[model samples]
Target: MSFDTPDDRKYLESHEWATTDEPIRIGISDFAQDELGDVVFVELPDEGDTISHDEPFGVVESIKAVSDLYAPVSGEIVAVNDALHDQPELVNEDPYGDGWLLEIDPSDESEFEELMDADEYEAQIA
Candidate 1:
């Protein structure tokens, strides 16, 4: 099945989003959470931590395996979804909403170009 990439956000091949807003939200894509089965835990970076593009920002543990959550853009983490610490299943129930992982203040807006658009990312996964 093809996934939908909302026009408002930029997507990463790793299945994260970088919004063009003050605080960028990061979350696993619906396709990703579906493939992951039940999300058991999400180990994410703390606020104020700097993360590099295409690098592992944290870990997402599922019943199937532990996957690294990659940064789609370089930035300093501004916030994290505290709810996931106690209720990791949120990632499965709402991969694009309440399941969001973190928010970052991007270091550079141009770095977003390195990420794929909806169609390109869809082709890569296909």
Candidate 2:
């Protein structure tokens, strides 16, 4: 099935997508939330937490399965989606906007540059 993948963001092979805007906002892709069926819970890194590129940073639990949330770039987490704790379905409802997981101050700009662009991400998922 086709999924919404905004042209403004870059994506990881693990199905996480990151915004090109400042502070590096991130979340799971539309295809990911759909595959998970319904998200029941989300465990997020605390603000100020240090996360490494391509490393597991948190977890997203769904009725069908639980998945590790990987960081697409190395950075210090600046903000987290507090709303997800009470409303995990937002991940499925709006994966790119209100459902965004974290905002980071990237340690490596080169890493964000390496993440798959929208077209490349769609091709990968296809």
Candidate 3:
């Protein structure tokens, strides 16, 4: 099945996606939510927490399995999707929009550029 691999963001092989916009938004890919089935819980870092590129930042638990959420870039987490605490289904319903995991103030913007583009991400998933 085709997934929404938006060009405005970069992707990790682990299936996380990070936007290039300011206060860079981060989330799992549409493909990942689909693969995981219904999301039941999300364990996220509190705002102000520091995360490093390729490091585990949180957990996404689904009906099918629990998965670790990794950082696509190193930075301070400025915001987290508190909505997920009460409405985990949002991840399955809108993985790219309201389902976004967190926002970061990147310490190294260059890390984002180093991640795979949409085409490369799509190809990896394909």
Write down the lDDT that model 1 would get. Answer: 0.85
Q: Evaluate model 3: give its TM-score.
A: 0.98
Candidate order by lDDT, decreasing, is: 3, 2, 1
> Candidate 3 local accuracy as lDDT?
0.95
Cα lDDT tens digits for candidate 1, 50-116: 9998999999999999999999888999899999999999999988789999999988888888887
Candidate number of the best TM-score: 3
The residue pairs found clashing in candidate 3 are: none
TM-score of each: 0.92, 0.97, 0.98
Q: Model 2 segments beyond 4 Å from truth?
A: none
Worst window of 10 by summed lDDT in candidate 2: 105-114
Best by lDDT: 3
TM-score of decoy 2? 0.97
Worst 10 residues of 3 by lDDT: 105-114
lDDT of 3 by residue, 81-115 (tens): 99999999999999999999999999998897779
lDDT per residue, candidate 2, 1-100, as tens digits? Answer: 8999899988999999988778999999999999999899999989999999999999999999989999999999999999999999999999998999
